[model samples]
Every structure is written in structure tokens, then in C-alpha cells.
Target chain A: MVRNYLYILTGVLFLYACGSCGNKGASGTNGLNDIPDDVVNLGIAEISEEAMQGFVDNMSSPVEMAALIKSLNVGYSNKYLAPTDKIEDYTTNFQQAFSLGVYGLDLGYLNMYNKTNTVLDYISAIKTLADAINVGQFFDFTTLKRLAQNNQNLDSLMYISVHSFNQMDNYLRKTNRSNLSVLIVTGLWLEGNYLATQVYKEAPHPALKERIGEQKIIIEKLMIFLQNFKSDKQFQNLISELSSLQEEYKNVSITIELGEPEAVEKDGMLTFIQHDKSIVNISDETVQRITQKTEDIRNKLIRK
Target chain B: MRPYIKTIFIFALFLALARPAFSQDISELTAQCAASAGDVTYLKDFPAKLDAGTPGGKPPSAKYSMLLSKNTAYRFTICTAPDSEGEAILDLYDMNILIGSTYNKATGKDYPSFDFKCQKTAVYHIFVSFKEGKAGNAVGIMSFVEKL
Candidate 1:
């Protein structure tokens, strides 16, 4: 009887574990859960608490970290939006607009994530957005789509994720303890570059290469700050896993051709060939690669 | 065992509760007063709930007194709905200019804000109301602010 009772108790515990840990249900599209909780809070903290709730004010969905930069009044020279103050408004508005423009993909990704709250959902939404791009539903912003086309599907997603992560990366590097920030940013930075490589293989864009090079500069700066966290196990493990993934995608390149390449500038919009469509069609091999990286990172973080 | 599980669980539960609670914070009132037709006023007895679902519902209506300023911009922003069935309409007038009007299907975000530049500084009367027929526990007259 004692043995039977023990068996029953063990079975109950097993059942609870299984039920609690099963594939988290379809979280819609945003995959917010995949992000570390502290990261999310910190990301939201980047946006001002007052401005955080006013999505309609911007006429666009919010990217928590990016929006936080606006709320910090980091770049604002003038306090209010009176027409009499041209220089301040021009500088502030231009900076705000530039941030908004640069964050298009990030905002879209966040919206897609909020609309659907899981990894698969986010992937699905990206695929849908890709399909929309394929069908010409996107506004023909020459430069924006041009930046997107370099990676095809996964590449753009990677870019969006990486760039968005970089916003936090920059903030963390600036405000927080250098050691902890470097460890986390380095992991995300490598992860960004790794994912970029996969998209690069599908489609190649020279401008994206330029951006990637810029990202490298940031990463190198981060590396200098890494020595402090060298002994931290979780940080070390994440960094190692991210490095491995980065190494795997090291050679992959994304190729893109702007329909009117010369007609576009960072200030302009252009027609972009679909580079990321291939993500929707990624094969088992690609799945294995991503899953391996994801699992390694998860294990490192989840372990006590 | 992770010590933070219950803490995280309770926190999550609290946020889930807070989201709905915040959305339902809007209220409709009965503050009606007499002023010129162009004047805008805050509606009294706001937060009138709208219908449950399926269109063909009336937007909530409220009369405001001396709420409209001649040369200022006024806007309405909504916060919550019981379900998906609620609808709100906002109309703006400036010295009979019929400056702006909008309608929105109730979701969790603010909506239907009307904007127009005011030409005069006199008090202007404005009207806001729900569609005559609707059903649901929707919040009405979420909030309105007029800026000069």
C-alpha cells in the first residue's frame, strides 16, 4: 500500500509537470513570452509611463524600448510643440520621426507579437506580412522596404529583432552596470548576427552588409565590457551558445536588388524584392538549427 | 522548487485583473447646460454601456454645456469595452463649422477623437450621444480634452 501511494503521488506530480510545461498555447503572434521577463520590463521602462498607454497618439503600435527613448526626452531640445520654436521642434520632430522611421520593422514586429503572443505566432505573422509584401499591401517606402529586402524573410525578422534588441542593448550599455549589460548584449548581438546570416543566405543586400558592419562595431565595444561577467555561469553559457549560432551563420549572405536602387536614399522609400519569404518555406534542417540554438539558450537560463 | 513561481503567478494574475479594471475606468455623466449651438460641453452621466455585438446599435449621446472653445482643438479618447460590441461617435462643431467627426468600434484602446482649429474664443455648445439602439456593458464618454 505504501508503494502504491508513492506511485500515485509521483504520477500526480508528473501530470502536473507535464500539464504546466506543455507547449505554451498559441500566444497569438508577438512571442512576448519568449523574451526574458526582466528584459520586457526593462524594455517597457524605456518608454515613459505617461506616454506608454497612448498608442493612438503616435498613430502606430509602440516598440517598448524604442518608445522609451522618446519618453526619456533624450533628444528633445524644446519642451513643447509651439510653432514659434522652429529649431527645437525641427530637431525634436526630426529625431522623433527618424526614430519612428528606423523603428518601422521593430514596431511591426512588436505589433505582430502583441497580436499573437508566441514564437510560432510571431513567425506566422511575419510570414503573413511577407505574403502581404509579396502581394503589394505594404506602403512603398523605398528605403524601408529596401532595408527589409536584403534578408528575404527570416533576415528581416532577424534584423527587426536584432535592431530592436540593439535599442535595449544601447540603453543597457549606457545606463546599467557595464558587466551585466555586456554579457546580455553580446549574447543578443551574436544571436542577431547569426540570424542575419541565415537570411543573408536567402537574399543578399549590400546596404544590409553595411548595417551588419555597423552592428559589429557595437558588438566589439560590448566585448570590452565582458571581462567582468566572465565568471558568471548563466552569462557565460548564453554567450557561448550565441557565439556558436553566430559561427554557424557566419558565411551566409542575403542578396537584394532595389527596383530603383539609385532612386532610393535613407530618406526615401523603394520597392523591395521579397527576401524573407523563404523563412515561411524553411526546411527541417533550418528548423533544427534554430531549435538547437533556442534550446541551448533556454536550458542555460532555466537551470538553477 | 523555484521560489518565485507563486510570486510570478500572483503578479501575472494581478496584471490580468488590472488590464480589464483600467479599461472599465471610463464613466458617462449627466452634466448638461445651455450654451450656443457651437459651444462644446462635457456630457454628464457618461460611460453609458453599448451593445453586446452584431452592429445595428445606437451610439451613446450626451449634451455638454459651454464646453467648446472657439479657437481650440478638442478630442475624445476611449479606454475600454465589455466585449467587442460597443461603438462610440464623436462630433465637433466650431461656430457651425462642423469641424470634425469620427466613429469607432469599441476595443481596448482610445478612439473616435475629433479635432478642429477654433476661430473664436466664445463658449460653444457641443453634443455627444450613443447610437439609439445598442447592448453590452461598454464604457461611454471615456474622456475628452479641448486644447487651445
Candidate 2:
């Protein structure tokens, strides 16, 4: 998706870098110093700091999610993942950024299942997307590829990949490219939700069921961010797509009932935990409805 | 042109020589703060820069937002370069609601770390900065203990 944005950037550079030579209204070349700043092509939006922070707290780590699913012993299915061949189809910034995230979660899923053979395809695609987005400096593709090639020590691979992503996320925020950050996180959340709902449909488990319902809250935050950039036609479409999932989740309520709290000191550290339990009251019909919406949105996202 | 080249060459040399020192200072202090946080598994640490020279609403602050799962306990270890002066403070906030802080400035003491027991699996925010709104560098480390 990001490759498409290159054309827009080239157009922008051509308009601005002409240095007034092409700004004579088709009559004659203007002087170097007379270039207008408002010459009709400086359109782009950034993710606000507040919305970026929301994404930071909002996304559950894909690796962690995949790890959970692995622990549950669910069989892996590539059918649920965005195919590697579709990598080149995503040409726009929106498609690239969002699918970068989708593929990221898919990588985690593959890693969790120790599917080493399929991992390189994802790393290459992710690297291409990262380079397109200009955050490729932080993604150590060589190191990561080496780890994947080794494939014996999974923890090291997980740690390195997570670190690479964390650095990218931080660098993006530091440089105020929160739009890309948000898209990446959005992809992660969407794919993670899709995986859970898919797995839950196959095997009904309480934990996974709760996980699906709890996304109602996450989807609500995601909707708010998507709304922030609704000026973009694609974001508007995304908002529309997620709004359906939100509708299914509207009735899913999570209430916290406080339990006994205790404080214990271990190794000179004061550790305290509130024994509070959260009850997610979601209907089975609601879960099915949410599953459908999640699949729809996720499929729409990865369909290209 | 010859003088200009000599000046540029000197400045370049200085930058090359000083770059290591600068990295050493921040990285060493960060490692110190991180090591002091105790036996929990080390997660990723974020760099923080607090400065008085920054413009409005600017302070060297790092905000970490992540899920602190319910029935799970987490410990946040924050180390600042100016901790000797009790300047670095880390605060835990839940969805815009201020929960707690590292140094209860009222007590004039800085705890190297703080623990949080999540009652609900919700997003939690960790805000790191220097006390008194001063300028400095710092790091915050998060880890889970006894996932019961």
C-alpha cells in the first residue's frame, strides 16, 4: 500500500523542488525566490499525540496474543493471514501502514507456531513496508533474518523483533509520525481480534471468548482515532467498517467488582495487587455478531 | 576557504570525540537505574529527557501505555540521572485519572520503583519525568511478577 504513496511524494517534490522554474502559470518560468508555498499539493495529516498515546495503550502485543493462542494449542491456519503475494498490491500509505501491522501480527503467529519456512516471506514484506514508510532504519532486517534462519532459540527472535518494533514505534512518535504508528497498531489490533474470533469459533473457550468481548473497549478507542482522520476518504471507510464491529460490541459491558487487596514484600520490592475481577457480560449472539463484523473488517483490510 | 575548512574539521573532530561521552553518560545512568529496579524480567526501556530550555508544555517526559492485566501484578522501575537530587518522578495514571507517583515529593524521597496490582484488564499509563519539572535523562522499566 505504501508504494502508491511514493507517487504522491514524487508529485509533491516535483511541485516544490522546481524552485519557481515551473510556477509561471504556463507562460514563463518564474524566478527562484518567487515560489508560492500554497501551490495546491501540500495535503497530509498527522496522528495527534493524544490519539497516538491511545494506540500505545490500546494494542495488545501480537506476539503475546500469538503466544496465548499457541499455549491453547490451536492449529495454525494461513487462510486467516494476509497472503505474502498480496504485499505488492498495497501501494497507498494507508494500505501499506495498516497491512504492515497485519503482516506483523501474522509474523508473530508464524513465530509462535515455529513455522520457520514461511517467516522470511513476511520479514521481507515487512521490511519493504518499513522502508517505504521511512522507518526502516529501526527495523534490523538482517539481524532478524539471521535469528529466523537459526530458528532454534525462539525467545531471542521474539525479543529482537519486539524490540525492533518498539524502537520503530518510539521513533515514529518522537518524530511526530503518529499516523503511521496508529495505523501499525490498528493493524495489530484488527489482526489479533480476527485471530481470536476465528479460534474461538473453532474451539469455544472462556478465556478467548472474554478476549473477543473485551475488544469492544479497544474497538471504541480505535474508532475515536479513525474518526480523527475521517477527513481522509480511506479513514472514513475504515470508520464505517469498524462502526459495524462497534455496533456488535455496543452491548458488551465489562464491570469491575473489587475484591480483597493485599501487599507483599518480595526481594525488597513492595508488591501490591488488588484482587479485583472484571465480569464481561456478553451474549453468545453478540459474540457471533462481533465475529462476523471482525472477519468482515479484517477481510476487507487484507483482501487486496 | 582554508580557514573555514580548518574550523569545520575541528568541530567535526570534537563532535566525534564527544559523541561517545554523551552516549556513555545517558546509557550508563540508564543501566544504573534499570539494574536498581530488582529481579523482575527486564522489558524495553524508554528514554526520557527533561529540560528547562524547552518551550511551553515541554519537559523531558516519557509516557508508556500498555495493558496491566487483571489478576496480574506489575512493577515499574524508573531511574533518572538526577535521582540523587530526587528529581526524577514516575507516576501511574489510569485512563487520565492520576493513580500514584514514585517520589511523594512531600516525603522528599524517591523509590526506585513502584508496584501495581491491576483490578481490571485495562490500559494503564506510566508518566516519567524529573521532579520539580527540571531537566534530565531517565528510563522506565516495566515487568510482571507472579501472574496469579
Candidate 3:
């Protein structure tokens, strides 16, 4: 009897472990198989869907731009942010997802500047948009709101807000809603660029200019991502609009010079100082054109 | 009867020990990693779970590609799951050349985090793997430290 019980128990444990392993394998795939036929049937051969998803997943966070702006001592202005009142205008999933990214960047900016009062507005707007897209569960609004209420918790607020956005992005990709993820990313990128360009127009900081010029790399990447979904009419229009922006970016040249890499260990932490540097040769006229184009694209998208 | 009771107890012990390895929550692990990021502004995270490599073969690693702007200081911090047997090592690479890593091969040391002062505006790769190709779970967090 003892031997029989042991055999049965081992069998149950083995079956349970196997079942868990099977589920992990199923979820590990990019969910390409579960994607709707219309979505994946398009000729997306130039870049594999997984690669595109990875690109989208790894794009820079908006908070980095906001932090840079704050570090530059650029005065905080609510004028550059998308108005919070327009959330209701976004009815389609594309609009909501994209605007969610827009508001998320704005929230990051507010959190960086300790603009506590306006933070809630963007958070609420984000929550509404997140819920619309079925990703609201990631937000933890009550905790976010409480954190936002205290200026002393700026770091915590920033971390939680950005963490929530990352979670939403990850969940979207895992469930095969990468098209929506792309829209959210585009919206965030457009707004961040718009803020930097607008600030550059007024402040004209060298670091800010170099940062704006670096958008050439990002816009090119975004254009490729948008093209992957060009079979959809909405994506087609986005591609056409961003292509003009990409054209302006062509005039901005980035050159890389390789240098010897150096690493240092201090207090048990390793630090790498990259010797290879990139030089951005962007003409002021080109920046002006890029700025005008960014404003145009941003206004058209947000206003509609 | 005594043998049967002992067998049942052993079985329960095995299940208790193995459950955490399989059921560890990635979000919780990621939060722990984020905390290690300190006051730097959080940007994004790369969470990976890799199985051990075959004996005498290449160790498995998870790679993520990111665009790092010119003249910016970014921090990369790593946290491994409590139940994992491996220590996570994160390496930053440009093209095929290694730029930096959390572990110093020459010194045989491991750091929980590292800072990369990126001087280029191009796509770079972040590779995370376990020491000795052991199966493990880890989250690598990229945070903005400053603009250089």
C-alpha cells in the first residue's frame, strides 16, 4: 500500500509539472498563431513580427525625455502637453491607445516637475483609456493617486507610473495586440519629439538640439514599425504623414566614431564609459522644418 | 503504516520546495529590480526566464535591442528570482562587440548593477544570461541617471 501511494503521488506531481511546462510554452510564443487572420495575413516579410514586437518593446521611455528636459532646467509648461479634456474625443481603439501613450508621456513630464495638481488629470485620462483597451488592471489608480498627491514621493510616483505603462505595453504584446502597442508608442514618440522641438525653439540648448536630432534614428524605426501595419487604412495614413517627417530627418546626419571602451569598478559597482561617440550634423533650417512637421503631425492626430 | 506516512511527508516536502521555482511572480521580481534602480528615473525593463544550456554547449542568453541616445547616462540594474540557482549577468553590446557587463571576467566578480554613459545615438543590444548557463529568472531595468 505504501509503495502504491508513492507511485500515485509521483504520477500526480509529474502530470502537474508537465501541465505547467506546457502552458509556459504556449504563452512564450509571440502569440502570432493566435493573431487574427486579417492582422497577420498582410505581407510582413521584410521584418519578422517578433522582431517588430521586440523593437516596439525596447523603445526609450518617455520619462527619459522628461527627465532630460527637467535636467536642462527648461521651464515646465503645460502648453506643450496634450489637453486632458480631449480624452472623450478618442472613440476608436487606435485613438484611445495612441492617446494613452500621449497622456502617459504628459504624466511623466508632470511627475518629473512635481506638478502634482495636473498629474491626477492625466492619470485619470490614462485610466479611462487603459480601461477602454482592457489594460486598466495594471494602473493601480488609488496608489498612483496617493503617490501623486505627495511631492516628496516624486521618485516613487515616476517609477510606479512608468512601471504601469510598461506593464500595459507588455500585456498588449503578449496578447497579440501589438498593432495597438505600436499606436501607443507612436503617440508617445510624437509628443516627446514635439515637446523637445518646441522647447528647443524657445530655449535652444545644445544638448536639447542634439537630443532632437537623435530623433532621426527613432523616427526611422517608428516608420518601419508603422509600415508593417500599412495594410490597415489608418496605418497607411500614419505612414504617409510620418514619411514626410522621415524625409526631413534625412537631412540630419549622424556619424559614429569608435573609441576604446573603459570600465571601472567603484564601491563594488561597475561603470562603463563608452568611448565611441556619435556626432549629429543637423542644420538649424532642417530642425526648423522638422519642428514644423512634428507640430503639424501632432496637431492633426490629437485634434482628430 | 510508518513507511507510508514517511513517503507522504517526503512528497509534500518536495512539492513545497519545487512550487516556488515554478510559480515565482515576475512582476514581483521586477519590482525588486526597480527598487535597486535607486533614485534614477525608471525607463523600461527586460524580464527573461531562460533554461540551462546543454552540458558543454553554449549558454543560453536573452537579448534585447535598444536605441541609446548620444551623451546620456543610463543605469542598468538586475535582480534575479529568489528561487533561481543562477546569478544573472547583463552585458551591453554595440554591433557584435561587448561594451560592458555586470560581471568582470578578469576579476571574477559580479555587480548588481552598472552604469553606461552612452556616447552614441544608435541601436545597442542588452544581453542577459545566467552564470555557467544555469536556468534562472531575472529582470534587467534601464533607468535614466543623467544627461552627460
TM-score of each: 0.23, 0.76, 0.85
What's the best-to-worst order under TM-score? Answer: 3, 2, 1
Between candidates 2 and 3, the DockQ winner: 3
Model 3, span B4-109: residue lDDT tens:
6676757765774555445347767787788877777778888879999999998899988888877788899989888788989998888999988888898797
In Å, residue B136's CA in model 2 sits off its true spot by 2.8
Docking class for candidate 1: incorrect
Question: Which one is best on DockQ?
Answer: 3
CAPRI-style class, candidate 3 = acceptable
Model 3, A235: alpha-carbon shift in Å? Answer: 0.6
Q: Which runs in model 3 stand beyond 4 Å of their true positions? A: A1-49, A53-58, B1-24
Tens digit of per-residue lDDT, candidate 2, span A1-304: 3444455445544544442232121111221122122211111244555656555453656655775666577889887777878777877667777888888889888877878778889989999987766666557788788888887666556655665677667665655555566778889998999899898999887877877877877777777766766666777788888787788888899998866656565775655566657878888899888888888888878855
Best by lDDT: 3
Tens-place lDDT digits, model 3, residues A161-221: 9888887887766665777788889988999999999999998988889888888888888
Candidates 2 and 3 compared by lDDT, better number: 3
Against the correct fold, how does model 2 do in TM-score?
0.76
DockQ of each: 0.03, 0.29, 0.43
